[model samples]
Target: MARPQYILQPVNPYFIAFSLAAAFLLNLLPWGKLPGIPDFVALVLLFWNIHQPRKVGMGIAFFLGLLMDVHNASLLGEHALAYTLLSYGAITIHRRVLWMSLGVQAFAVMPVLVGTQLVPFVTRLLMGASFPGWDYLVSGFVAAVLWPIASVVLLLPQRRPVDPDDTRPI
Candidate 1:
């Protein structure tokens, strides 16, 4: 029996930049202040970091996080710290994680999402800020749930074109 062949597509840097920008803009929307809306910027960042480690990494995540912190009017380094950690986690297990099914991928990324959420929570707690309650966790859950969809959507551009002549790929 012939094994399945995976066609690898070349990723365009512009597409990545555009998606991250869109995610940042989405994060700027008021929906994030709601109970269940996940951090869109973090989500997009993780997606790219996992699938395109060479293209997206801690530096990009940190910069975006700083932008988010400024936009959110929160402590300057809070989001930067969280996103940097998240990016590190994503890149750490990206190869292993992407080989699994979407459901498994969702579960695999929980640690990264937790880190992203936990940093801000811990920072606020240490700063004597009031507890945000369990509702804050809802965003992580929501990001997990959205993983499959985000994965599929973001992968669209990475789908390789069919090669008519090549029946079996080495």
Candidate 2:
């Protein structure tokens, strides 16, 4: 049998806002400083970038990045630059990504996710901050691991009903 295809409904803007806000709030939690804690906002932003590029563009990523900079008390544009580039990369490959299996998709996004972490990391190093060690890059991989889960959860709102009537054998 062929794999089932889903025709998702149009995404609601309000749901998008709520997911972004929730991700930011999750980032605000204290556990965020720990290594391997995925960047929830980055994950959410990338999800929307892939699935709804027109709806969530680089502007929103930049804004969230700025907010993160303020919250982390780091270089003002560090995260802004990283997130904006992440958004750009996601949007660029969104079409190709949509066709992949969840496992393949995770690998596809790994580079983008890791690069998002690298931007801030290299920025800090250039500014003379001490090395944070390789662990600093762990979150990116963690975020990639969460990609499949994030895809499922975020797409929940748009998933069409599986129920089929005789006239519509979906």
Candidate 3:
């Protein structure tokens, strides 16, 4: 039997576009005061962080975070700072987290999610906005909860290995 040839492939543009669209859609969803559906963009970003860290890193995170900031009409650097920091954290643990079980990865991401949200929360506080209440933290919990699902979804396509030999013309 011929040995399976493994190739280091470039990142798929489709996945990047799809993930970005999903993120934007989720951001636009009317989740007014809801506790379950937090920032889907953040959840998906975490998925990509582990799966394709090189392709999607702080630059993408910063851009997406800025979009969210503009959409939400919040302070300009609020989400930007949070996302930049989150991206750095994700890259730091990408290797170790990749080898862990899904549950473990999800649990590990929980704090990062919370921390991302807290940055904006604390920023608002410092800017003299009234306390936004604990409800704000709900988004972090929701993001964490969705991490496993997002990871599974993003990884599904990559699970099936491609046959390099099959590419030869008949």
Candidate 4:
């Protein structure tokens, strides 16, 4: 399958940190609880977890989750638990994910994305919060839809230049 580009160099740790911070900032924007607004943090976390598990592991996921929890001011560990689980799922399948085409990769990771949302949803319900309806899952689907875009953007820094000769790649 054709990829956006192959990585020719090691991914920089700083870029990973920047991407996570940017995603968190995106989440901080006042969307006023829109049902379909995707969770930018979760999306980016999953991307990095899958693509660079060593650099962005569950610890970072938990830390970011804590920040999210504080910002949302919901139950203390909701986002942390969710993001950790998401990271675990991604890391487990990272190798397989890298081989698949972007479109298939999105579908492959859909469950992890949606399940990440599920953690907080279930927690809220267990604590007597009202059912948020099925729209809660919409963001996961949206994130999956954006999978290809995220992969391309995140991989840009690590991409190799294509060879001038058509026979050789990267």
Go through the candidates in order and give the clash count of each. 0, 0, 0, 0
Each prediction's TM-score versus the true structure: 0.90, 0.95, 0.85, 0.91
Q: Please report, in order, the local distance difference test score of every candidate based on alpha carbons.
A: 0.88, 0.95, 0.81, 0.91
- Tens-digit lDDT track of model 4 for 105-167: 999989999999889989999999999999988999899999999998998888755445677
What is model 1's C-alpha RMSD?
A: 2.4
* Tens digits of per-residue lDDT for model 2, 1-170: 87888788889999999999999999999994589998899999999999999999999999999999999999999999999999999999999999999999999999999999999999999999999999999999999999999999999978866564688755
- Pairs that collide in candidate 3 are none
Pairs in clash, predicted candidate 1? none
Candidates, ranked, TM-score: 2, 4, 1, 3
| For model 4, the run of ten residues with the poorest summed lDDT | 1-10
Please provide, for model 1 over 49-120, each residue's C-alpha lDDT reduced to its tens digit, 9 standing for 90 to 100. 999998899999999989998998999999999999999999999999978888999999877886798899
Model 3 score (lDDT): 0.81
Model 3, span 1-170: residue lDDT tens: 85344343555779777987888897898778765567777777777777688888999999988998999999998998898888888888889897777788878999888888899999999999999888889888878877788876776666555664676632
